[model samples]
Target chain A: MKKLYGVPGGEVLELDYPAVADYLVQFLRRELAWRGFEKGLVAVSGGVDSATTLALAARALGPENVRALALPHAESSPESLADARLAAEAFGVPFEVIDITEMVEGYARLRPDMTPHRKGNVKARARMIVLFDLSVAYHALPLGTGNKTERLFGYFTWHGDDAPPINPLGDLYKTQVWGLAGELGVPEKIVQKPPTADLIPGQTDEEDLGLSYARADVILEHYLKGYPDRYVEGLGFSPAEIRRVKELVNKTHYKRHLPTVAVLSSTAINEFYLRPLDFRIELE
Target chain B: MVRHAIVQLAPEKGQIRRNLARLEAALAELAEDRPQVVVLPEAFPTGYFLQGGVRELALTAGELEEALTALYRRVWEGPLDLVIGFYEKDEREGAYYNAAAYFELGGRGLVHLHRKVFLPTYGVFDEERYLSRGGTVAAFDTRFGRAAILICEDFWHSITSTIAALDGAEVIYVPSASPARGFFGPRPANVERWRELAKSVAAEHGLYVVLASLVGSEAGKGMSGGSLVASPEGRLLAEAPVFEEAALVLDLDLDRLPPVRYDNPMLADLKSGLPLLLNDLKRVVEAL
Candidate 1:
């Protein structure tokens, strides 16, 4: 599949996950076995994506070696917690429930007028705080749970949902999450649950965004397929939704990049140079 | 010991069933030699389209059951396990995932299926829309060792490997259908970076790394092919020729590994904890 990280239409190399995980396991064990970490820690929200990550962690490190930290806010559904536990236990990993209701409440009460965006940001950040704390206490790397779908739309709070010491599942999309989750033995309840932020009560991700993930994903799929904008409009999406998403794509373009600085000198380094881009330049 | 091969095969444009058939034939031919384990590259069945029509080309877990399961059962001369890349639809769940399926010899059947976790967003790969993200991290049990699977972007992140190590994998195999890019430089030198990363990840974790890269062009991009097996010490034990198709077999002494982290004092120290000093340093730099 092609990825856009500032560069337009860059192709990504594909690897087999088990083989990659096998190699990765050896690397981590040799590097961190003596580091006193008894386990690996990840924040799972009962969603297929996180559940998949948790399963990977457990399988790669062993159930005992993997731990799930569920940081739920007051508005988060009870089923979300149940799903998280179901996934963790199914994978044979340890589970920890850290209700962030108090923290979210404290922040909300402290700032009653906080905008939804700001409140969402707080909820995400609060969850991360708990996750990081758990990681430190456990001496585990904080595994990130954001997927390609969320990352593509800039749907996550930076340093909040996106923050992690290391992310194993960052390259996958929302749809793929379900695929791997089933293979990894994730419970059906979590996989079937409609995608949600669970930041506020009565909020489904689609309702908040004014588009179904399926539709948004189809749009994204077509956009990546190199369809022109006019062709996209023929698909019967509301102009407003298209405009909002397109505006999002434009405005959030910067989110996909390292901050650009005015070149003060002749040579400015970029990931482009990691392997001479000249080689990648098509010969005339 | 059972010799194994993970071929990173990229097919000619728009030939899904044919390519898969060719793969099955090639694998069956190899099976005649009695290799115990085999792995194939990502999206090998439909090819890595990275764009539209992938959903149509993608295979569901059930659809794959007949082909892959039968292949494993039919090809087995001895104890063998196989992992292959395919696009899988979960009809029950009503979702599609970039999936890898595992089959064991003697008709053991459906060992595991894993989805690609890390979807790259920074390059010619736009996997975000084509596939859903997976949430689990674990190893598939293998006779060779406690093995695990990861697809495409999963290796870029360190977590997948690290967790695999702690879980008890002695060897890590990676199957890749990386589109080749022609370069003027020493191609091996170019591949050395990935080798270094893989070796470092392996050596630090003290496990063997086996990589299989796709040969030939797929769609428009060319692959830089050089599949190699590395030792726990990060030394190349055997390697397939670059930018071409070849199968390499090498003996690995799992016994040679340090046995426990005890042999590597660095491991113990690392486990003690990352220095608080580093966090402080990072904070200071961020403040600026």
Candidate 2:
């Protein structure tokens, strides 16, 4: 029998920008409206991922319905703030600046020996608090901007950037986010900027993660697609890099889920008490 | 061995004449390949976004037969078969159906008309409100080989594909007009999801699964055109570009079908387990 299969390892995975943009816009609009809200709030950090999310939201629920919040701290990059403003103006969405330095400092007063990581966590949680509070005040849902790479590496603070009700960019890898940013007409400077959590001054994402997002995305894509470690290594990835990626992904598993409750009965809340939407209760 | 041509089109909404013209032009272009079988996207004649105007856009059974016969005479030669999707008006029942018809060149008329069994009424789809459901699934002998036709949502249900395969379908043609959705990574998420479905069906059934999806946008919702041809061994033979109009011609080797089915006897296992499944189903229903 003749082999009809094409050559192996030649498949190229790419996005159709126009189609993807249209789909996401429609999806966001439908989901938000279905949940009984017409407005959305997106925290813009002036990075490609958040900018893309903000643009998509604005396009979905008109710019008048989308609000941008720039929560910057004393240690935050000034360039990030400027870029956030630039993005807001470019997309014609209303934005507000909330300095989080005082909030972070007030929390620091409680513990004088706070490490940089812990301080970053405080800033992240403080921003989320502000965003959520404004979500209620503005009658809008808070949109998450964390990309797939950040979520996989546990780069986001739990209950901080990850606590938003809706996430449009959560599935996009860091590199793919840049592609979408270009398609969404985000400012070129922001799209090309080095990705940073902006938790602290002078800290870059690549330096903190110890690898470039391009390499990390490739490794994570292969790993997430169920490729064996040996096969990924054969595709020009170092074993050490693969091990690091796997460890980060494994360690972050807890952050992706809610706290587990003990199950003592058949009708445990988490297991048996499924989501309301899952129930097939029909109206007569 | 048979060469199949899968045409991915972006039909104008509610414009049957223009859409047919476009399809005729595509068939004329594809004639150079001399494909034994040609498949087009679902609802290519009247487009997929027909809600209130479906009855107006639908074709009576005889009208559809006449249109197809005319099209076949214009573009096809000896033994060239075409599988195309349209909205068929059931004159006797006074209802409409999402249907696919198989036309063999130099034959009497439409060899088979498979109505879509699953009419999705969920988000973005109000098919049930506009069209009645199909009731049968069977495979028939074609010029290429034993083949079956399935409309978009019909192939999503695994049981439909299983029944087709059990009825001795060596090749399953799925014509879809699914909109593009979700971009999780480099690839469109909807396309990835479809790939998983196609691969599972082809691998388990040990037959070729050919999908031809429509492209273009309607009312701001876009259809990602990533038509695919998967082998019995669950390998992708050819994949067309997404969100673009393209015709893919792939030469399929039918000789590999027997060896693949021998290696993986999934069908045999399913056939053996049917009695037990039926018994359990009866018991469960009775208890309920």
Which numbered prediction scores highest in TM-score against the true structure? 2
Which regions in candidate 1 have their CA more than 4 angstroms from the true location?
A1-284, B73-75, B182-184, B188-190, B259-262, B265-288
| Candidate 1 chain B worst ten-residue window by lDDT | B180-189
Tell me the tens digit of each residue's lDDT in model 2 across B1-288: 899999999886666666777878888898889888889998888667766466667887568767766776787777668888888888789989999988875675678889999999987687897789999999998876798999989998998999999899999999998876555455677788888889889999899999999886664456777999999989899999877799999898999999998999888888888777998878987999
Which residue pairs show backbone clashes in model 2? none
Which digits, one per residue and each the tens of the lDDT, describe model 1 over residues B176-284? 6665332213453336556776778777777778777666543224455577777777677777765555666556677777663446544446445546556976898
All candidates: TM-score of chain A: 0.75, 0.93
**For all the predictions, what are the DockQ values?**
0.01, 0.05
TM-score of each model, in listed order: 0.47, 0.57
On the 0 to 100 scale, the lDDT of residue A65 in model 2 is 98
Which is the leading candidate under lDDT? Answer: 2
Q: Where in model 2 is the C-alpha error above 4 Å?
A: A1-7, A10-13, A276-284, B1-288
Q: What is the per-residue lDDT of model 2 for residues A157-268, given as tens digits with 9 covering 90 to 100?
A: 9989899876777777888788888899999999888888888778999999888998999999889878899988888989999998999999989899888888999877
lDDT of 2: 0.84
Please give, for residues A7-100, the per-residue lDDT of candidate 1 as tens digits: 4543233334443343324333432343345567888887887888787777668888888988887667888898888888898888888888
RMSD of each: 24.5, 12.7
